[model samples]
Target: GDDDHEGEFGASSGGAFHEGEVAFDEVAQEADDDRDTISLVVVGHVDAGKSTLNGHLLYALGYVDQKVMHRNERDSKVMGKASFAFAWLMDGNSDERERGVTIDVGVNTFATEHRRIQLLDAPGHKDFVPNMISGAAQADAAVLVIDGSTGEFESGFHAGGQTIEHTVLVRSLGVQQLIVAVNKMDNVGYSQERFDEIKKEVGAFVKRAGYRAEDVSFVPVSGFKGENLLERKEEALNKWYCGPTLVELIDRLHPPVRAVDQSMRMVVGDVFKTQGLGLCVAGKLDAGAVRVGDSLVCRPGDVEAVVRSVDKHGKRRRHARAGDSVTLALNGDREELDNVRVGNVLCCPRNPIPMVCSFLAQILTFDIAVPLTIGFQGVMYWQSVNEPVVLNRLLCLVDKQSGEISRKRPRAIGSSSTAIVQVTCQRAVCLERFADYKQLGRFTLREGGSSVAA
Candidate 1:
């Protein structure tokens, strides 16, 4: 009778209900299929209005709850000035809220007219640079916010500016598309000349970092006023500007496409157990595809297991392709899960490689005050692990911009110096060629509890 609804729905009682159900199902399916999600990370120097920009973007997109805004406004009145309201949306911890700054990476999801965005807001202060690296490693693209009014770009000894260092770091992490937001336009009176100057400097720096100048988009806006972000307004300010708004640019930017390879490889990012799901490992599928019931060898650990299930976004899937953030459940005992923790590789049994104890890496220094020398102890961050490491030897000092070796075994590499060095970690860790896997290859060195660079 239900099947007959398609033939004569106007005749029978069950026919009308069946026809309505089918229509509802089709509409729901279309809605589910229409979604396009892109993951982006927002990063910049401290007090660059990163949190403010994130708040305004969400507010304009109708993603900010009205009650939250009301509470913020009421609190601002009590505090005697308008504090950062959007900071609350990202930094939920009370310590972060009281400090009025972000320390760790904060993730939030928002939907726009064009697509859905999973945004990672990273801390901008120098002290939290490690957290920034962690967030950028998982992002597809980045939004670098700069304060237009201060124009304080160069923090260390480099002539270009700190934004230059930030750009190079983001590029090294494999972020192809970049959106440069020159915030605090209201403080600068929305001057086209100022915006152009910052844009030019930043564009040149981006180019120097091995990124195409055309790949960078510049948007001048006042995050506090919510100007030139999601909506376009015809005003006396910024009359010379004619370009896509921040939200427009974000929607227009496409996700970074991964090149598929037949070789089987996957870098583990984290290991956890979900409710009702035991011993799940999450990470991007770097190459090849894995289906449920396929056998995989946990490299370095030398453990073997059958993929009981592949869960993605709460749905059990038959297989996972490259670039998918998948969770693979094991068909064996849970204790073996520790063997596949972050930094472990997943591959076939025949192609296992040993995790290296020491490696040579080209490193650039961020803090110039402290000279990087041989046997300098600092924290090393790669993938999700941050541990103490010693810089065993400075093989050669290289020029930052030219990429030419300046000296062999220099006594010390100062700020703005790039050098190739042999570094030994406190423990064995997995690392791939930077060209092969940028996510796992790149690392940040920290000294005196401050991040220098990768």
Candidate 2:
């Protein structure tokens, strides 16, 4: 439910609404010149130490204090899970803490020497893969944490495991940079052989998933022992692995090019109400810039709202640009604002994002039980939106090496094939062509609880 409002937000009866109509090109670069901001998603199989690793990183970076750490330890011990103290820092929900598994996306912020990272901690279990896809959609890079203990790595890397699925999903969502963190090395006695074995296997898979060799790096870490995260102190670990620590590796990552000068478009991730700020929405800016007092429209409902305030990483700011994860307090009609939900896009009124029920997409199919033909049905995942969709037409199949059309109007396309397909959604979706907007255009198709294509 939303509150009742009378007039347009930030608008006067005199018809003067020019407060937020400034030229963005002149000031987009100067807005956040202090450092580059990167939205990073942490993903891996269940119990792979994704949360624990990031929890330790936060403590090491001084984001969590001693008092908070002691409280978490006391509470976790009372719950009979003393080992989850660090993980409890990120998994705050009671359901997640009680079950000892992450059920939703855990978000936090930290900074390196030259970059600010907005961390999106995704759930590892199969039931929450939808939440993981939403988190990955907003990220510029990802770190796939793999358990390094003897049989654990094999189980997670083998067929029907979340490791390969997570790897493929992130790459498909346009996450070009990757870091395969080999976690729990201490359980293997900090063995270099074990670390190398994981690196070799994961390296091959990432390559097959379309990640370049230079864009991918491997690091051995002990999330529980807090080794090689911020600093390497163990003699056993330092014996053979002399590469950069996890923090150092993150510091070296290159920020992706953004579309700050383009039209404003931000995909909503979550919506909630604050004590004083009536209705607030959090999301990542896909392109252009947003500022307080700017009038914007939310698609799928044509809800108009004004940016009452802007907060980036919990700090209020006047302006924010593309690649920045922010929460905005929007002022508008209570009934209209109530329609604002996750997967909706907020953009400039001059050019609202296109909302369509169908679009042409180029998808790379994975191993499927049957060939994909016209009327094939599945859920299409785009950003934070997932809708029931059906394949309308099988346009053609393209040859991988030659990038030329191999067949026209094929009867069906099977696994390991590339094809131009027409897809129709159950409802209207805000999107652009892949050539126009990569973040808005790319999507994943999941059928029967498994990712089928992307």
Candidate 3:
């Protein structure tokens, strides 16, 4: 059961609403200039060391103290995977450890002198691409970890590679800064030729995926050995590489500008219940601010909940703003939790997300086995929600290269195609025009266990 108040949170733990509101406003405003938090998501192909790299980073930053590492080492050794000790830091699930693959998103936080990074470790296997997108959508920048081991890079970077899919997906989701970590260099004796070759191949594809070459950086690293992550190695170690370490490149990236002034809107990335706090929703505040006692609406259902409390980066806060990954505790009708799930929107009571049965979206097809035609059925993944949708009409065919309209009404869109179409989901969804909100606007269509369009 929920508390009696319909829209107002009963009382602040800090006492009077006046004092809480004043402190909340100050905290939200300070974030605008502080730039203290930067959300970074790691993406790449499977076996590319994404977990090990992030785990090593957590170690170098002192987040994984020696005692923790020792325990991880003892546990991994007992399981006959002593080498997996570093990776154990992020792959916390037992199933993931047994399969030796990341099955879910791993999230942790680390700090540097300039800013704090909300590190998101996405599973690299194509099977987990949906989970990867969930992680990517909430990121400010990304690091594509490439395998430097022999023949491994080719398989992950060539046609039909996770590299292409990952790069396209992240860019489509609005991540501009990309740091390509050419990891596992020690396996090839740290050869400069190998690093250059991998960099050149990756850079060409990244540029085609809509990222400027200037915004992308490449550095040689060995996550397994803890090289070039936090500090630069000596010439004797990585002789040909004289550039900054992984942390240096990350610290140099400025956090993206936030939509702090827009009406408060946050997509519920996860949901849970607490003993005394009632319902809690965690997500990035896509725009504006939320205080301790604001009224909010959950739609697609138009349910109501009062902001019970706010938390950011594991710290209890009086307020949260755009770009900050926050969790909101809500007290309202208990049944409201039934309608709210991952991918639901929580927004200002008066300006809730518009739920629509159908909408027109300009789409770029990646590699579909067949042409997308009317009445086609597939899953629509957006803002952490994966719901079924049907293509109702092919409004127009677009130029393959230029993206301009080439035909008024094409019958279908094929592999490597572009078109604008009317998409009608099986259920109503909170959606907006792509041009209006890039974060919430883009999505992917998957069918037959493969991504057909993004």
Candidate 4:
């Protein structure tokens, strides 16, 4: 059903709606404070020590005190899994602890002398890859944890390894800067030779994934012993590796810039109702700003609600801007806010975001057994929006890399090939042309429940 229809912005055939200007009141501008924050996601293969490394870093930085450490130690020992003492700080969920693995993204905030960090600790298991994607969508940079134990690096980097998939995914999802932490060097005796070997292999692959060599950095450390995480302690191989600790390297990362003055728009990643607070929606604002008493519209639902309050990093504020992860408490009939669910976008009325049923996109398929063609159906994951979609037409096959159209209508687009195609959904959903907004425009296609394209 490729039916053409007209609505708010007229026919949704061509040209994306360009949100012009917005008049954010002075009070709305008061909470317009800039944050020197780095939204960093921690990712790697299962048991790569992602949670251990992040948990220990927070503890070492005084974010987690001795009392919590003692409690975690006693509880881990009782469970006969003492090594999880550090991981307990992040894996607070009972199921994750029972399974001895991280299944959900754990968010925590900590500050360095130079910058504030919003750390997203993502699960590394293949089963939890979708959860990882959710966390990565909110990050500006990523820290890829790799197990340096004997035979472990190869296992995670080989053909069926999560390392390869994760490396490709983060790069494809717009993470330009990546820190490849060669963790658990203690298991390998902190050998510089091993580190060099890993650096050469991973460095080459990440480069092919569109990351510049300079933007991809390597750090050798032992998350278990907390070595080279803060202050570099003299180790057996200190002579060969004298680079700054992980903390120093992170602090040196380029601070992310914000778009606080553009048209107000924020994607709802989670929704809930509090005891005292009304309906609360949480997500990162891609552009513009919002404040208390500000009127906003939720698209697709088209439900209008006023902003009752803004909470940024646990502090209730009068306003908040782009580049921030905030919770907006709505002031209206409780049903209105309750009706607004995750994947719903809140925007300024003046600059209404385009919500459509179908659109054209440039897709790069993965190495799959089957090729893509007309009538292909898959789940489309755009931010928090996960919906089934159909490939209505194979508009044209394009160059694998350059994206130049090569065929008007190919019988099928093979694996690892690129093409511009038209896709339709059963119901209307929000999507913008990739040319307009990278965050809202980009998405991944999954068929048979596996990621098929990006």
lDDT of 4 at 199: 95
* Candidate 4 structure quality by residue, lDDT tens digits, 1-454: 0112121211111122112211122233234335477789999999999999999999999999899899999999999999999999999989999999999889998877777788999998888878888788778889999999989999999857788777777766777889999999988888999999999999998887778887888999888789888966756758788887899888878755555545677888889888766588988887677777777888877887777667887777766666778888776666666689887888887677897888888888877889888999998887767889999888888876565778898889887777888889888888766554566777888887467888
- Candidate 1 has an lDDT of 0.71
Using lDDT, rank the candidates from best to worst.
2, 3, 4, 1
lDDT of 1 by residue, 363-424 (tens): 87764577888888888877556878898888998865577888998998887667899999
Query: Which candidate ranks first by lDDT, i.e. highest?
Result: 2
Q: After superposition, how far is residue 383 of candidate 3 from its true place, in Å?
A: 1.7
Give the candidate order by descending TM-score.
2, 3, 4, 1
Q: Which stretches in model 3 have alpha-carbon errors above 4 Å? A: 1-33, 234-237, 400-403
Backbone clash pairs for candidate 2 read: none
Q: Report lDDT per candidate.
A: 0.71, 0.86, 0.82, 0.80
Worst 10 residues of 3 by lDDT: 1-10
The best candidate in terms of TM-score: 2
Candidate 4 ranges with C-alpha deviation above 4 Å: 1-35, 400-402
Specify the poorest-scoring 10-residue window by lDDT in model 2: 1-10
lDDT of residue 433 for candidate 3: 63
TM-scores for all candidates: the values are 0.77, 0.92, 0.90, 0.90
Instruction: Give per-residue CA lDDT, model 2, range 268-320, as digits (tens).
Output: 88899987777999999888788877889999889998887778866777778
